[model samples]
Every structure is written in C-alpha cells, then in structure tokens.
Target: MEWVYIENISEYEGKEVEIKGWLYNKRSGGKLFFLLVRDGTGIIQAVVVKGEVDEKTFNLCEELTQESSLIVRGKINADRRAPGGFEIQVKEIELVHLAKDYPITPKPHGITFLLDLRHLWLRSRKQQAILRIRHEVIRALRDYYDERGFVLIDAPIFTPSACEGTTTLFETQYFGTSAYLTQSGQLYEEAGAMAFGKVYCFGPTFRAEKSKTRRHLTEFWMLEPEVAYYDLDDNMDLAEDCISYVVQRVLDRKKEELKIIERDTSKLEKVVKPFPKISYTEAVNILKKNGIEFEWGNDFGGKDETIISNQFEKPVFVHRFPAAIKAFYMKRDPLDEKLALGCDLLAPEGYGEIIGGGQREDSLEILEKRIKEHNLPREAFEWYFDLRKYGSVPHSGFGIGLERVVAWICGLSHLREAIPFPRTIYRLSP
Candidate 1:
C-alpha cells in the first residue's frame, strides 16, 4: 500500500493507502463505524464496517477515543457529502497510542481556558486556520520586498540603546553592563540601508509596555524597510503597495483558511492599491466634526485611529503629524518646521495602525540638537550621528507589525490569535 496524506487522498481513489494521523472524532451505527481523522494537512472520514474488516479491527474501533494516534490503511472512496469530497474504507488499523481522557473535547471552551491550554489548543481547527493564514501573510510580505530589490538584513536582539524611546525599553543586566531588548529594528536598518542602498529587517522585537489592550504584545515580529534616497512620499507609496500585495496574496491563496475563520472575504478583496491619504490636520478636523475631542499634538489612540480609518474603504494614511508627538529622528517638514514628515497607516474595520514610517533627519547638527532637546543621552547615539557627519542622503523607512496585519486580514478580534505563541503583558507561558 502507498503512504499518503489526508489532503491528497483524492488522487488515490479506489486504491489502498496508509494514513498516519490521529482520530478527530467518531460515530457508530451498529456494525458500521465512521471515524474522522486529521493529518494536520486536512481531515477525512474513515469507514470501518464489521462485515468487511475482522472482528478484532471492529473491536479496536469501538475503543478509539478522540485524538487517539493511529495508522490506518484504507481504500479511498468519493463521497460528495464528505469533507474534501473524499472518504476512506478502512482495511486495517494499527494503534500507535490510545489517548485517554483528552482535556479538549468537542464542546466549546472559554478564551482564558483555551489560552491556558494553548500548547494543545493549537491542534484545534480554528487555531490551525489562523496560523496558516499568518504563514501566508509573512510569505507575501517577504516576497513583496524581495521582488522590489530590498536586501534582507537581520538585526540584533540586544541593543545598547532604545530605538523609539526609553519608556518602553526592556531593561536587563548584560554581563555587568545594562542593556535592552530592541523595540524596533528601524535604527539598525537605517545603517543597513546606507550600506546596501535598500534593505529590510524582519525579526522579533520586544517592548516592555504594560498595555493590556487587544493590540498590545510584549514581544512581536516587525518588518522594517529602509531606503537611502526615498522621501516621505516615496515611503508612503512603498507601504501602500506592500500592504495591498500582502492582502491580495492572502485572499488568493488562503481562501479556505479565511473561510474556516469566518473572515469577510469581500472586505479583504476591497483592499486594493491607492489607499486614501489624509493629513493629520484633516484627521483632527474630521474627529472634531464628529464631536470627538482630541488634542492637536497628541498621538492618536486605538479609538481615534478606528474612527479615522472607518471613513475610508481601505487602509488610510494619516501623515504630517506634529514633531512634538513623533520620534526625534523624523525629518521636519520644510513647509512647516513643527510638523514631522511621518505617516501612520490605519487599517479599516477598527484594526488601527499597522504601519508607521517617516523621512529621517539627515543633518547631524539638527539631530544632535533634537537629542539634547528630548533629554536623551547623546553618547549612546554617537555612531548614529556619525552616519550624517561622514556622508548621508535623504532616506525613509516604515515598520509593520506582523500580528496586527494578520489580525486585520483574518478579521480576528484580538492580535493574540495571529501569532502561534503570543507573549502579552500578563500571559507568557505556552
């Protein structure tokens, strides 16, 4: 007999093949037993009839429980009503391990309970689908950058200083010296961009923020793309094109997984190119028009981003925020020195910001002045300032949160489902 996976069972129709997997569920009707088996790739029903198989085989089927590991030899049969339009007629059964009293059953489980058993809960159908979609999203993200001539530059996990700000740094003692987990790879990627012209860093980033919101994760993956000669407008174009490509790729390939998660495919299909762009001033005006109070120099919260993004059909870019609220590295707009040439891409349907980028300051004197004004340690950024002192050109880059993008594409309520093993403010194990 030929060995086969459940997903490819159709090609072996009317032929005996050995399927090594675990029993998902079973139903019995007198002499016939229907065993549903999943092999990670897919699921199919295996029919065990007493008249065809030996009495020992029939007795073994009766003792089978949910998630019992087994190797089944069966002949594939076409069944339009069966899942994947295929079923199997069992010829032999070999028990590998009889799972006794599995904690997760056919019944519904609460979110907390499920999260506690996250290690095993990943075997569930819905979780599997979510992870599969996440895989596709990452693949599409890398493909987009690779096709666009971006060099992959892996950044370090440990850093001497903070990338964004010191408030969210994960501080720890590093072999007698104080160090921090990198919050963003943007600063390192800037150096890489200067070397390779156009480069990107895709890796895990850490933040010690004590936020318990659905969007907050203690550790998450970020994709930071930096270019040596791109300005704020060029940065916006890159972000828009990348996001649209990722969404379209997920829609094209992960249709079944999206259906399993009950995602609204129509909404994702509308995520095409040419996302709407609005200035921070216009966004504030729109908020005020809706009777929502917001300070001009304050950063937009999740609620504010949702309100602003809901007005557009796809992701919207809110640009040119006040420099006081943005990072010190952001370039000041020539037309208005108080406004930074930065943009935040807010996803539609209340997913909030997924991408943040801006043109970087190229002048060493101005950067040094901003560092002092922000009360940051100037010595820590000496090497960074040296880039400007030697030779520097106008450049821009953006960072995209992987989980946030996955959540938006899968229509997940929380970002935790987007990652296989999420590290949140409270929950860390499993």
Candidate 2:
C-alpha cells in the first residue's frame, strides 16, 4: 500500500491508497452509500458497500456528516459517473474529529449570512476561485514590472503627511506621533522615481469613505508606478499594457478556475490595448451629446464615467480635466490654464476609474504653491519637496486599485467578493 494524494483519478486507479482528508458531504441509499471527500487537491466520491465491510467499518463511515475530518484507507479506481470522474473504494475508515453541524449549508445562503461566516465560507468553490484569481493577477503584475527592470519600492504605510485631503485618512498614534494611513502610493513612488529612474509600489492602502456603495472599500491594495524622464503619455502606455497583460494572463492559465467561477470570458478577451482616448473638453462634449447636463468646473461623477465608458468598444481614457476639479499636484496645461495634464481610465461595462494618473509638476516653486494652496502641512513633506529642489526630471505615475480591476476582469458585481477578507466602511472581520 502507498500513501497517495488524489488530484486526477487516472493516476491512482486500481491501487490501494492511504487517504487522510475531511469528509465534505455524504449521501445514503439504505444498505449502499456514496461519501464525497476532499484532500485539498480536489474532491472525489467514496463508494461504501454495507456487507463488503464489517459492522464497525460500516458504522464508522455511515454516520459521517459534512465537514467531518477523517482518515480512510481505500482502493483508488475510475468511475465515469463520479462528479470529478473518479471514485474511491473504502476498505477501512477512522475518525479524526467529527466536525459538528455546519452553520452554513450547501443551499443558497444570504449575503449577510455568508459574510458573517467568512472564515468557513472561504472554503466554497466560488470564493476559492476568486481569491486564487486575485493571486494570479498580483503575480502577473509583479512579473510585468520586474521584466521591465522597474525597481520595486515599498511605500510607508504610516506617514506624517497626507495626499490630497485629511478628512479621508485614518489617523492613529505612531510612537507618540500622529501618523495617517496612506491613501495612494503615487507621491511616494514619485520620490523613488527621482532616485531610481523607474519604480513601483504594491501594498495595502486605506481610505475612510463613508459611502455604502458596491465599489467602495476602506482598505484595499494599490499598484502604483512612477518613472522619471517620462510624461503623461508614458504613464498612459504603461497603464494600458500592464492592465491588458494581467487580464490575458489570467485567461490563459486559469481557464478551469474561471469556468468554475462562471466568469464571462468574451468581455475579458476584448480588453486588449489601444484604448480610446478623449480630452476633458471632448469628454464633456460627448456627455452633453448624451443628454448629460453638468458644469465644466465640476469633477465627473459616476453617471459621467458610465456615459464615457459606454461609448467606446473597450476602456477609454478621459484626459486633461479642469485643474480646479483635480489634485493640485498635476501639471497645468500651458495652452489652457484651467486644464491639468491628468487622465482617468474607465473600465468597460461601466466599471468606473480603473486608473488615475497624471504628469507631476517638477518646478519647485509651482509644486510648493500648489501644496500650500491646498492647505497641506509643508513641514511634514519637506523631504518630498526636496526632490523638486534637486534635478527633478518630468515624472509621471498612476494608481490602479487591485480589487476594482479584479472585479471588472472577473465580471463580478460587488467588489467585496474580489478579496478574501474585504475591509469595507462597516465590516472588518473574518
């Protein structure tokens, strides 16, 4: 007898095997029965005959319940009717610890019920497939940058300074000092870009959004890269390439996982580059043509993003938004003082704002002016401003929320399902 782990049944057919696994589900048909078991590689059916085994063996396997941890000695064989196209012939059975009645059943449960038992709910096929896809997406992202010779830089999670605003930051005591969680790694990556030429940061970022929308998460992962001697065009090219590559890689390697999760692949296959580009003025014109009425100085809302994304065959880049509606760090367009050199990439199917990027102002005087005008503390960011004092090349970068992109690529409705342990505005437990 050999101790074998079952993945594909053909590999171990007609052989006596020692198996240790948890019982997932059981079905009884009087004197004969079928027990489904999983050893993490995959699930298989265990056919038990009542008279073929002794009374003790029959009782040990017969009274099994869902999620019961057990060790069964069996002969591996092929059965076309098995769910995974395999079956196990049980000769001996033993108990580890009977997993008591599970609070979660196989039947369809409410979202609230599932979230409440997220610890156990993660074992389900849907969630397991999604989180695995997320892992692949992250792996693809790292390999893409590493192959391009981009240095991976880690940004500070706790900073004395903040990006854009103070109201949305999570403030806490840091060794007797007030430090806030980072909202985006763009600013930090910009500083690294000045030193390393090209750099990227992938890490958890926090935002205290008060809304209860399907898109908002208080804690999420962000992939941001900044490159010196590059302008807005450079960033747009990198964002498109990086995004398309991840989607393509997932489709190629994880087709089985995708099928199990029931993701629509046709939409994902159409995510190739050469995404349509439109200027802020042009975007506003299109919105007006689509019967959207909005002021020019105001920033785009969800409605505006949907209208722009719907017009294009794939993702669209809406660029050069009004300076008043964007962050002050963006470089102002010389041709139009009111316009800033920024771009927002909208995902297809109305998945809003996949990427937000812009050319950064390299002038020491201009950057300082914007920082002060925004009422941000200059003393805390003296190190950041020093890059401008030195030979600061024209730099650019963008941030893509990992969860949002994954949700769109996987064709999932709620962004919460994209992560294993999603931290939202209200929920923060396993």
Candidate 3:
C-alpha cells in the first residue's frame, strides 16, 4: 500500500498504489465508472468496473460527489488520452468525507460571486495554474538577484515618514507616535546599497490609493534593487536584463502551466533584452501623434502608457521625466535641469508600467531643498539625509510590482487574478 501523488503516478505504472485526493468529476455507463481525481499536484482518471470490484465499491462510486475526499487503491495505467497521460484501475475505495454540494459548480459564475468564494475558488484548475506560474515567477526573481551578488535586506513595514508621498500612506498610531505603512522599500534599500554596494528587498508594500483601476492594488508585493554608483543608464540596463531573464525562465519552466492559463507564449518569447528606450519628451510626442491631448510635463496615465507601449514590440524604457512629476528623491538631469534622471519600464501589449526607478539625489543640499519644495517634514527625513551627508555616491534603484508582472505574464484581464487574495478598493473578503 504505497501512497502516490497523481503528478508522479507515471513512475508507478503497472504497479498498485493508493491515491488520496478529492473527486474532480465522474461519469458512469451501466457497468463502468470513470472518475476524475485531482490532488494538489495533478489530475488523473480512475476507472471502476462493476464486475471486477465488489458491490460496495461500485455503490460507493455511484454516491461520490464533486470535491469528496477519498483514498483509493488502484493499479496505474498509461493512457495517451487521459488527463496527464495516465489512468488508474480502481481496486478499492475508502471515503474520508463527503463534501456537501460545493457552491462553485461547472456553471458560469459572476465575477462578484466568484470573488466572494475566493477561499474555495483557489482550488479551481485555472486558479491553480495561475498560482503555479506565479510561484515560478517569484522563484525566477530570487534566482536572478541572488546569483548576481545582490544582498537581501528586509525593510521595515512601518516608517516615520513616506517614501513616495503622504497622500497615499496608511497612517497608524504607534505607541503615541505616528507611523505610516511603507509605500515602497526604495528608501531603506538606499541605506543598504551604501552598506553592501548592491542590495534588494522583496516584500509586501502598502498604498492607500482609492483607485479602482484594473492595474492598481492597495497592497502589493514589490522587488526593489538598489545599486551603489549606478547611474540612470546602468539602472535601465539592469532592469532590462533582469526582466528578460525572469520571463525566459517562466517560459522554460512553466510551459504546461502557461498553456493552462491560455497565455500566448509568443508574446513572452519576444520579451528579450535591448528593449527600446525613449525619453519622456519623445513619449509625449508619441501621445500627441496618436491624437491624445497629453501635456509635456504631466505624468502618463494608464491609457497614455498603453498608447506609447503599443508602438513597440518589447518593453520600452521611458526616462528623463519632468522633475515636477517624479518623486523628490530623484536626481535632476545634468543636461536638462527640469528633467529627473528617472525611468519607467512599460510592458508591451498595454500592460502599463511594471518598473520605476532612477538615480537618487546624492547632494545633501539638493535633496534637502527638494524635500522642502515638496513640503515634507524635514525632521522625519533627517536620518535619510544622513546617507547623503556621510558618504553618498551616484546610486540608483527600481521597484517591480509583482502583481502587475503576473497579470502581464498570465495575460490576465484584471490585477485581482494575479494575487491569491486580492484587496481592492471595494472588495476585501476571503
């Protein structure tokens, strides 16, 4: 009585083993029953013959329902047409628990209805595939950074001040002091960069944005990498290289999972290095050419980003944004005083901005002035200023939103499907 998983059932072909899982589906024709069983790993078909088994076993098959837990002993058989190219001839059955009529059935379910049951919906085939692909994407990210000598640094979840802005921060009272949820780990990684030369932090970040857009998430995961002495161009190079590697790894390892999610592999295959680079001025020109009434200094919205990205076959780096539109930490372009040396990597096929970063302001005087210009509290950022005050060199960093990348890689229509439990502006249960 060997316990086997459906994923590795092929190894035990022609051998009797026990499979402990839940019934996915079932069909019976007079004397024969074909039961589709799925464990967490994979799915397989188990056949039961009435004459071959006792009356009790055949009767139990008749009473089996969807998602009913059971342990069955069977001999593995290779079948080309079966799920995962395998099948089983059942010899015995043991019921663990009979699930009372599952709510999510084979019928078409509304989005709200499906989201309400997100706890159980994770067991569905599509969700499982999406999650598996997500797992591989995360694995690829870790592998890319770790092999490149980047030190892993865990940033604090709460901070005395904001990294991006105070408008979207989640304010909280911490022991009679005001603390805000971190919007990005970029600032903390800057300190780490000074200490380790190349450092990165991968963790959950919070933003209290009231946006209901398809690409916005209140709570999402971010992978921010900071490199000491890396300028804007060097930062762009790292971003393109890292992204190319992660996408290829997903394609190589998660082929079957990609097929399950119906993603067009060709699109991802085109995501190689040497991605097109354009300036903020050029991107505005593109928008104007496309009949968009976009101003030169304003930040690009979702629609504007899609229009510019659609012009290229690969992810495009739009750099040298107006200093007014970028964060206060970004360094101003030496060639153009009003432009910040920042860049955003926009995913092709209208996926929007996936990565954002730039060379940070190394001059303590300029950084202090920028902080004052942005009307930020100077005392809260005194420790941050110390990084520049002590020993600051040309440093750059960028953050990649995990959910946005997952949505783009999976070709998902909405950001909610990218995460296990989505917390949107409206929905936040299960």
Candidate 4:
C-alpha cells in the first residue's frame, strides 16, 4: 500500500492508501465504527464496517482509545459531510500502540492545567492551527528580507551589556566574568548593518520582566532588521511595508487555519500600506481627547495603547517619542532635541506595539554623552561606540516581536498561545 499523508488524501480518491497516525477520537454504532485520525498535517475520518473486514480487525477497533497510535489501509472517498471534504473506508487496521487514559479529553480545561500539559496539549486541533499560522508568518518574514537583499546575521544570546536598560537584563556569570542575556539584537545588528549595508537577525531574546500581563513573555523570538544610512522616515517606510506584506501572506495562505482559530480577517485585511502616522504629541492629544489620564513623556501602557489604536482601523505608527523615555542609542530629532527619531507600530484591535525601531545615534560625541546620561558602563559599549567613530551614517533599524504578531494575527487572548513552549514569569516546564 502507498503511504499517504492526510493532507494529500484528496489526490488519491478511490485509490487504496495507507495512513499512519493516532486516533484523535472515535465513535461506534453497533456494527460500524468511525475513527477520527490526525497526523501532523491534518485530520481525516475513517469509517469501518463489521462485514468488510475480518472479525479480528472489527474487534480491534473497539479497543482503540483516544490518542491511540494506529495504521490503517483504506480507500479514499469524497464526502461533503466529512471533514476536509473527504473520508476513508477502512479495509484493514493495525494497532501500533494503545494509549491509556489521555489527560486531554474533549472538555474545557483551565489555562494552567493545559499549560502544565503543554507537551501533549499541542496535539489539539486549535493548537495545531495556531502553530501552522505562526510558521507561515515566520516564512513570510524571512522571504520579505531575503527578497530585498537583506543578509541574515546571527546575534549572540550572551552580551556584555544591556541593549535597552539594566533593570530588565538577565545577568549571568561568564567564566568568572559577568554577562547578560540579550534583550534585543538591534545593537549587534547595527554592527552587521555597517558591514553588510542591510542585515537582519532572527532569534530568541530574554527579558526579566516581573509583570504577569497577557502581553508579557520572559522568552520570545524577535526579528531585527538594520539598514545603513536609513533615517527615521526611511525606517518607518520599511516597517509599514514589511508588516503589510507579512499580514497579506498569512491572509493568502492560512485562511483555513485562521478560520479554525476564529480570527476576524476583516481587521487583518485593512493592514495595507500607508498606515496611519502621528507624532507623539498628536498621540498624546488623542489619549487626552479620549479622556485617558495619560501624561506626556511617560510610555503608553496597555490601556493607553488600546485607546490610541482604536482611533484607526489599521496598524498605526506613533513616531518621535520623548527622548528621555527612549533608549540612549536613539538619535535625537534635529528640530526638537527633546524628541527621539523613533516610531512604534501598534497593532489594532487592542494588540499593543509589535514593532519598535528608530535611527541610531551617529555622532561619537553625542553617543558617549547619551551613554553617560543613561548610566550604562562606558567600558562595555566601546565596540558599539566604534561603529559611530568610524563609518556610522545615520543608520536605522527595528525589531518585531514574533509572538505578539502571531498573537494578533491568530486573535489569541494571550501571548502564551502563540509560542509552542512559552516561558513566562511562572512557567518553565513541559
């Protein structure tokens, strides 16, 4: 018998093929048995008749339990009522392994309990759809940069200093010396940008955030892209275009998956180019107009972001934030030194900032002064300062959190559902 995946079963209609997978569920009506089987690709229903196969095979189906591993030889049949517009007529059955008392049954489970069994919970249908969409998003992101001549550069997980600030850095001992887990790859990618002109790094970043918000994750993936000689305006242009392309790619390829998770495509459909842009001052005005007690120069919290994003249908870009509230590496606006030449792209429908980037400080004198002002160690940032001392020409870059984007696209309530094994302030195991 020819081994065929459930996803490709449509091509072999009326032809006998073999499928090897686990029984997702099963039901019996006296002489007939219906088995729902799932491989990693998809799920299909297999029907078994009492007289078609020998008594041993018919009796074997009775013992098959949930998540029981099995191999079945069957002929494919087209049926609109069945899932994936097809069903299988089983002729023979071979039991591989019988699972006993699977914990994840067809019942509602608490988040903590399901997360505790995360290894097995991934086998559920909803989890499968979320992960599949996540894969498409990752592929789309990589293709976007590669098509635009961006070289993929790998950044180290261990760094000598923090990229954002010291409060959130994960400190560790490095052979008697001190090191910290990288909060962002933007700093290293800047050096890569200086070397390659256009570069990006896709990898996991660590943050020691103590908060337990739905948007917070201790460990997550980031895609940081840096370009040489690109100012703030050029950076925002790239950011909007890149996001639109990625969202459209998902809408094109993962329609069924999105439907499984019940994502409102209408919100995603409006993610085209020329996203709404407003300065920090304008955004603050919006918050105050909406009656949100947000003080200017303070970073926007979750509720504040939701109020601002609600003003537009598509993802909005809020630019030129207060220089004091931004990272020390961000370049100050020439027209207004109090403002930094940075922008944050906030996802609509209450999904907060998914992308943050800005022009880097190009002057050695100014950078040294900013570092001193931020109280970052001067010795650790010597290499970073070298980029400015040599050939820095107003380069800009941004990092997109992969989990947050996946969470937004999938319409998931929590960031934990976007990642396979989420590392939060409280979770670290299976």
- Against the hidden reference, what TM-scores do the models get? 0.98, 0.94, 0.98, 0.99
Candidate 4: clashing pairs of residues: none
Top candidate on lDDT is 4
Candidate 1 vs candidate 4, lDDT winner? 4
Query: What lDDT score is found at residue 212 in candidate 2?
Result: 89
Per-residue alpha-carbon lDDT of candidate 1 for residues 117-205, written as tens digits (9 for 90 to 100) = 89988888899999999899999999999998999998889999887765588889999998999899888899999999999999998
Ranking by TM-score: 4, 1, 3, 2
RMSD of every prediction: 1.0, 1.9, 1.1, 0.9
Which residue pairs in model 1 clash with each other? none
For model 1, the local distance difference test gives 0.91
Candidate 4, which ten residues in sequence have the lowest lDDT sum? 161-170
Pairwise TM-score winner, candidates 3 and 4? 4
Point out where model 2 deviates above 4 Å: 1-10, 52-54
Show where candidate 4 strays beyond 4 Å: none
Q: After superposition, how far is residue 242 of candidate 4 from its true place, in Å?
A: 0.6
Give a tens-digit lDDT track for model 3, residues 228-322: 99999999999999999999999999988899989999989999999999999999999999999988888899899999999998999999999
Total clashes in model 2, counting residue pairs 3 or more apart in sequence or in different chains: 0
Worst 10 residues of 2 by lDDT: 1-10
- Indicate the TM-score of model 3: 0.98
For model 4, how does the per-residue alpha-carbon lDDT over 154-213 read when each residue is reduced to its tens digit?
899998888876558788999999999999988899999999999999999999989799
> Which ranges of candidate 1 are over 4 A from the true structure?
none
